[model samples]
Target: MTSELPPLPDTPPPAPTEPPAVSAHVPPAPAARRLSPLAAGLIGLATGAAIVGGTWAITANSGPDAPATFTLKGSFALTDSVVPDGNGGCGGTRGYDDILEGAGVTVYGASGDVIATGGLGNSTYDGDTYDCTFKVAVPDVPKGERFYKVEVSHRGTVQLSGKEAENGDFGASLG
Candidate 1:
């Protein structure tokens, strides 16, 4: 006896109706937004203004705490016959000792208030010019005054303009 096998179907099988079990359905991401040219420019301008404002505030606050100052430096010369004191300094008669080292140097402001004080350095005798020169330096003198008055060792004050005092271009002379 002979047995007959059934023939295969002509069409292919159908696709699956349900999604895969491993992954869930997700929506597409939205596109990135961009700022307009005018918006970008405004933002930059605002940032720059903030920085400038901060800097101005800092400088303004510090101005009062530490006022502007300058060093008042000049020479006080006594035109007299002086001899060398063997110590590389000048020596003169009584009452002339005031121009030597440690002499008080005072700087007065426009309102007659003392701004700063220092002392004279060693005296140098210039025999050629007959001048005993003493250097004076009054440091940290407050600025912004219309004029400055400098006095050395109780001597009469020498008036100087603000520009002259700040530049240290003024000097005192006594005969």
Candidate 2:
């Protein structure tokens, strides 16, 4: 059997076509990689120098009574395994040769004289808790609540100990 084919329809009119648009705007710049080694080193050196210079400047120009009494308080664990004197003696056969545990207090006197000093043995008394209070008085002071710093040191000797102390105020205040 032969199959009959359908006739094609009449062609419709063509639609309009527009031209592509163009612009003259500049492109954005590409991002840069990490800084060069030389640049990084210079920056690091500059930062270190600035820190050192600032520290020196501050220390050199402190006024009288700038830092007063440095009060240190903290608990220290004895490494010797021997208890404390229970009488603030900080007793040990070692004769307290080592700081074992200590609190550092930095004080400044009037006249722009800065002093770094600290205290020792701030811990419990005979197994009982104790508040170690160490005061490094700054001489020739004008008078006011002065600023101070506290540091603790643990001995590397036979004694395995630790200590703690806190200032009445922050580094900017007395205590």
Candidate 3:
């Protein structure tokens, strides 16, 4: 036997469409104001001048805080095959402490406790040329790692102390 079912409903109708409207009271958009060529050029020149002036000020205004002072002099004679000390140097041959007086020189840790003490000596090169000797013996410098400093007192005062490599080498740090 077949059972009866209800019938389907019809689709709804479409709605009406209309064009968008504008308001007569609203004003039109304004154009951007353009700068004159002369004005633009002057502005660019001023900007460039400002940048250059800033750069000049920065470069020219560098202050006077310089790094530490150190100097070393020695005979590089191959025949005088004097290698450096335990720190890769050796020189009782010829070296200057400080041409200027009060030039302080200090050597830190080395092998023994005996730090470097400075003094004057004399050396004879391959020829009969005599050389001035400035020596320093470190009294308590550590063996493997060491540090030293050589400072000059202002502009005068000669330093007769720093006569060894551990004393000073342009502020070099030894390992």
Candidate 4:
């Protein structure tokens, strides 16, 4: 008894599906555009400059008007019969040793608050006038007060109008 094989169908089996072909030469991801070292440095510098400029502008315009200030200038004249040593000070003349030199000068606000302090400069003696004159300058004294009080050494405080303080033509006299 011979076994018979089944008859093959006429329609051919469906063709095998294939995966799409991949390109081997994919263009390297566009070389990331790189900045030159000089360009990078310039950009960094510009950014830093912009930040600094912005900060400066904010600070320069934000604060109260620099507390309007003026140099309180004045002079002290001491009338004495003692002859000067021709130097800036008395220098042992008549038992006086530069009494005006380095003397404390104080500025007081309207509220009696101490505003500024300075020392008297050297004294110059005038032969004809018999006056030992010295100059004192209290720099950067705040303005806008109705009045100011100025005192030299232990001398009493002298009240001055705003205009007088601004003009800076006030002083103390001692004999």
Candidate that beats the other on lDDT, 1 or 2, i.e. the better one: 1
TM-score computed on alpha carbons, candidate 4: 0.59
Q: Which candidate number would show the highest TM-score if scored against the true structure? A: 1
RMSD of 2: 19.5
Local error of candidate 3 at residue 7 (angstroms)? 60
Q: Stretches of candidate 2 above 4 Å error?
A: 1-70, 83-89, 93-115, 121-124, 127-175
Candidate number that wins on TM-score, 1 or 3: 1
**Candidate 1 residue lDDT tens string, 49-109:** 9999999988986764678888888887878656677666775556676667787888899
Task: Please give the RMSD of candidate 4 to the true structure.
Answer: 16.9
Candidate 4 at residue 118, lDDT?
A: 85
Each prediction's TM-score against the native?
Answer: 0.60, 0.24, 0.25, 0.59
lDDT of each: 0.83, 0.42, 0.38, 0.80
Off by over 4 Å in 4: 1-18, 21-61, 81-83, 88-98
Model 1 scores a C-alpha lDDT of: 0.83
Q: Give the candidates in order of lDDT, highest first.
A: 1, 4, 2, 3
| Model 2 quality (TM-score) | 0.24
All candidates in order of TM-score, best leading? 1, 4, 3, 2
Q: Cα miss at 162, model 4 (Å)?
A: 1.1
| Clash totals for all candidate models | 0, 10, 30, 0
Worst 10 residues of 4 by lDDT: 90-99
**Model 2, 106-160: lDDT tens per residue?**
3333333444455443444344543223223222322342333233333321111
